[model samples]
Each structure stands twice: as C-alpha cells, then as structure tokens.
Target: MHWITTTHIAVTWMLVGLIWVVQILVYPQFSRVAARDFPEYHFAHCFRIALIVVPQMFVEAATAVWLLHEGIRATPFLISAGLILVVWLSTAVFQAPTHIRLMRKFDASLIHHVTLTNWIRTLAWTARGFLVSFALS
Candidate 1:
C-alpha cells in the first residue's frame, strides 16, 4: 500500500475514534459545568480540541488529496473524501455555532443540539474509518 493511503487511513481512524470520544464523553459533560465557569471551561474545551483537531484534519485531508492524485482505488478514496467533507461541513456549519453559543452561555438547548447534531460527524467518521480500513486491506 502506498504510504499516502496508509497515512490517510490512520488519520481517518484517529478522527473516527476521537469524535466518538467527544460525542460520548466530552460533549455530554457540558451541562454539568457550572454556568459561571462554563465560559472559561468551554473556551478551554474549544481551544484544546482545536489543537488536536485542526492539524489532524489537515493531515487527513492532505493524505486524501495525495491518494486521489495517485489514482488508485478511486472509489473508496472518493467516498472517504466525501465523508471527510461532510465531517468538515458539519463541524463548521452545525457544531461550531453550537459551541459558540455554549461559550457565551451554557445553554442546555445548545448543548443538546451540539451533542445530537454531532452524531452526523461521528457516524460519518465511523464509515470513513471502515472504508479506509477496507482500502488498507
């Protein structure tokens, strides 16, 4: 297997697992945070997650692009790329706004919305991880 494809699969799997952790463990804990301290906590959450997120996203994206350019196993590569797009779009369009509201105030409604909507990303990443694993196999 090409290293690009292998790296892409690895990074894709990382995001898949990380998103699940965020969905199951992190986001659900938002409501438990004291309102007065929520903003600071939310900021740290956003800041720290971004640290892991932004670079890994780039690595995944770069590897996807490289794999596409390599012109092997195009179908799986494209599907996985499309799923990555969905994850990015959903994160920016759906989740980021919800996080913003939480940063401003710990609204349970926003927390609910974020956690629920994040399933889209979590499932998409799951599918991506499966696809890339198939590619590796």
Candidate 2:
C-alpha cells in the first residue's frame, strides 16, 4: 500500500471516531446546557471544532483526490471518494446552516435537526473508514 493510502486511512478513521463522539456525546449534550450559557457554549463549540475538523477535512479531501489522481480507480476508492462528497454535501446543505441557527439562539428544533442530519456525516465517515481499511487489505 502507498503512503498516501495509509495517510488516507488514518485520517478517515480519525474522522470516523470523531464523528461518532460528536454524534453520541457532544450533540446530545447541547440541550443540557443552561439556556443562558448556550450561545457562548455553542459559539465556542463551533469555533473550536472548526479549528480541529476543517483542516483534517481538507487533508482528507486532498488525499482522496490525490489517490484518484494516482490512478486508483478501484471500486473501494470510488466509493470512499463518493462518501466523502456525501459528508461534505451533508455538512454544507444541512449541518452548517443548522449550527448557525443554533448559534443565534438555542432552538430545540434546530438542535434536533443538527443531530438528525449529522448522521449523514457519521455514517458516511464510518463507511469510508471501512472502505479504506478494506482497500488496505
């Protein structure tokens, strides 16, 4: 396996684990925050998470595209790339706007929307982890 593939797998699994943590632990706790504190907390969460995830996401995307450029046209590679697109589209189309709304005020509906739509990323990244790992094998 090439080093690019190894890097891709490592990053994908890292995202997979992080997304699950967000899904299971972080997002669920949003409602638990005191209403007065929710905006500050949500702002901090958005800022801090962006600092961590945005760079990793860019790296993951670049690596995936690099793999394709390197002539890896196998089914696993294509599927993994497609899944990455799904995650991005889900984030842009659903999650990010919902987070912006939550930032202004803690709307329970938006919270639910974010949590519900985030499954798109969580599942996509999880499947990506499997696809890359299987490609490694």
Candidate 3:
C-alpha cells in the first residue's frame, strides 16, 4: 500500500515534468511555426490542448483530494497540488476564452498571446513536478 502511494506520487510528478517540457520547449516552437504558416492549424491545436486541459484540471484536483485522504503528509506536495489547481482554474477561466477567440479570429497576434499565456502553465507544471517529488521523497 505504501509502495502504491509512492508510485502514484512518482508517476504524477513524472507526468507533470513531461507536460512542462512539452509546454515550454515543444509547444512554443510549434506555436511559432503555426503563427507563420499554419495559423488555422495552430488555432485548432490550441483548441485541442484546451480539450485535454479541461479534463486534466479536474483529474488533478481529484487526485490531490484523494492523496490527502489517503494520508500523504508532505506539505510541499499538498501545497503544490493546491497551486496547480489554482493555476488550472485560472487557465480554464481566463485563458480558455482567449484561445476560443483566437481560434475564431485566427490572428498572428493572438497566437503570440496564446504562447505567452502558456508560459504560466509550463512553469506551474514544472513547479508541480518538484513539489510532488519532494513529497514522495
């Protein structure tokens, strides 16, 4: 049971790290390319990310609650999970609409805005990875 909890924590952190890398390094490059030649596809890609993000936000929140209930007493992990929830909520509330508008308008400027907004998520997820790792240790 302890091993399972530890594994879950580790896996969560790994996922967070993977997501951060994708957002910070991979997605930005893709965004730049999309802005230049494939604006429509870029807009579509943003929408696709939103589709994944929305559900992921809920899942993370639920997982956090479950971890707490299961007696994970790492303050850093709990706090980080809480922060991630807040960030995800902000993304859903603030960024999602902006992305929707950008998707409709298909403007280069909007793509830049989207890319800038994604920085928050990238950093937040990276922080989450660190926090989770600390908790597991």
Candidate 4:
C-alpha cells in the first residue's frame, strides 16, 4: 500500500511538472505564434486550455490530499499545498479578471498580461512538484 501511494504521488508530481513546463515554455510560444499567424484559432485554443486546467486542478488537489494522508510528511506537504492555494488565490484575484477583460476586449495587451502573470502559477506548481518528490523520497 505504501509503495502504491508513493508511486501515485511521484506520478502526480511528474504530471504537475509537465503541466508547468507546457504552460510556461510551450503554451506561451504557441499562443504567440497562433495570435500572429492564426488569429481565428487563438480564442479556441485559450478556451481549450482553460477547460483542461479547471479539472486538472481538482485532480491535483485530490491527489495531494491522498499523498499527505498516506504518510507524506506534514511540513513539506502543507507548504506545497499552501503554495498551491496561493496560486489559486492569485489567479482569482489577478489573472481571472484579466482573462475576463481580454475575452471582452480581445486585446493583445491583456493576453500578454495574462501570460506574464501565469508565471506565478507555474512557479507554485513547480515548487509543489519538488516538495512532493522530496517527501516521497
């Protein structure tokens, strides 16, 4: 059981890491290119990303709790969870409104801001991934 739990934790951490890399490195470049060369596809791509993100967050939260309950240490897990909470708060407070406004205005400036602010989320997830890996080890 412990091995199974550890495996799940490690896999979930890897998933989070992959998501962050895609969000930070790949998605921005894709967005920029799409906006430049395929304006019509930009909004759809953004919408798809948003749709995927919402469910992934729920999965991450659930898995984090499971790992913690399965004997992952409190300090690192809680710290990582706290960081995740902060990222969500920042998204709600800063990024969501920007996205909403961008959806309304279709302004490139708003997109840039949203992408830039996304770094907060990326960093938080990356930190969480590291913590999980460490805790599992």
Best by the lDDT measure: 2
Candidate 4 lDDT tens digits, 1-106: 4764565466556557766765668546644553345444545655877786776676777776776676666687778878778778977987778766654444
Query: What Cα-based lDDT does every candidate model obtain?
Result: 0.88, 0.92, 0.66, 0.67
Off by over 4 Å in 1: none
Better of 3 and 4 by TM-score: 4
TM-scores of the candidates are: 0.95, 0.97, 0.70, 0.71
Question: If both were scored by TM-score, which would come out higher, candidate 1 or candidate 2?
Answer: 2
Ranking by TM-score: 2, 1, 4, 3
Ordered list by lDDT, greatest first: 2, 1, 4, 3
Model 4 TM-score relative to the real fold: 0.71
Evaluated at residue 3, the lDDT of candidate 1 is 75
Per-candidate total of colliding backbone pairs: 0, 0, 0, 0
Candidate 3 segments exceeding 4 Å error: 1-11, 25-39, 47-56
Compare candidates 3 and 4 on lDDT and give the better one.
4
> Which residue runs does candidate 2 get wrong by more than 4 Å?
none
Give the per-residue lDDT of model 1 (tens digit) for 15-120.
9889999999998898899999999999999999999988999999888877777775657657878998999999899999888878898788999999999999
Instruction: Identify the candidate with maximal TM-score.
Output: 2
* Better structure of 1 and 4 per lDDT: 1
